[model samples]
Target: MTKKYAIIDTGGKQLRVEPGRFYDIHPFTSMGLNFLKPNTKISLCRVLLICEGSNINLGHPWIRNAIVRGRVLHPCFDKKKIIAKIDSKHKTRKELGYRQNLIRFIVDSIWSNGKELVS
Candidate 1:
């Protein structure tokens, strides 16, 4: 049998998702502290497409009755990345480091056409 999956759009990116899988996604970190807590349930209704077995449902932008649900596993910052700049004539160099926060989500289920699929 063919595997069931769905494509979702979030944070300006698209992701292929299956049930019961965990993914790390950009949280669009804000200036202040985030209010999302661990184990909290989250729903993403921006499903772009859904594929079940050999059947495919496409949406102009987003499917009307498709939704993907997940649990917030954690919200944390990834490893720091460094940015450096060097000036030859000035003989000066500078370096900066930054960490971007990300959200960890474990997909719980996917619903399409009023039917739910849980992996």
Candidate 2:
């Protein structure tokens, strides 16, 4: 049977997630990372909508009780890289560096279409 699914918004982006799948999410600061602890059960409360069979449900603000659960697989940072620029025009110059602390998760299950499927 074709499984039903939902799309959720986290960290300002949309993710098409399914159970048993591992995916990366946007990085967060150390202080803000508490919300994404490893092995933590998080319900994606900001569901944009859901699809089951041929039926679709869209939320104005967010889907009510539309929960997608996932476990944090790991919390880590991406490789760092230098961002630099130099211009001889009026001696303009700029340099910067950045690294992102991303969260990896394994979707455990999704509750929708009046049912739950574990992956």
Candidate 3:
């Protein structure tokens, strides 16, 4: 069987996603995925490209009926990043830390034109 994958636009980023795999993405309000409980079913419709077997479908912007179905695994925070600054002349020091909110999900399948491309 040919391995299938797709390029999807979400959370202001393009990601290559495959079925039955887990992926982490920044939480975005536009997708209305924030605050979702675990195991919640979701369908992402902004597929930019899809490849199945030897057939590839490239959308001008987005395929008319192409959608990727998945379920939310859970919500989590990414690794913390620390930032530090120091000024000798000013005799000042500062430090900051940040952790981005992220959501993990498993891609169950990819579909295009009413056909299941990947399972």
Q: Pick by TM-score: which candidate is best?
A: 3
**lDDT of the structure predicted as candidate 1:** 0.85
Winner on TM-score between 2 and 3 is: 3
Residues 64-96 of candidate 2 have per-residue lDDT tens digits of: 877888888888778898898999987988999
Model 1 TM-score, all chains together: 0.88
TM-score of each: 0.88, 0.75, 0.90
lDDT of 1 by residue, 15-114 (tens): 9999988988887434222666788887889999998887899999999989998988888788999999999999999999999878888998999878
Model 3 agreement with the true structure over 90-119: per-residue lDDT tens digits: 999999999988999999999888998744
> How far is 117's C-alpha from truth in model 1 (Å)?
2.4
Candidate that scores best on lDDT: 3
The candidates, ranked best first by TM-score, are 3, 1, 2
Model 2 scores a C-alpha lDDT of 0.77
- Pick the winner on lDDT between candidates 1 and 2: 1
Provide backbone clash counts, one per model: 0, 0, 0
lDDT of each: 0.85, 0.77, 0.88
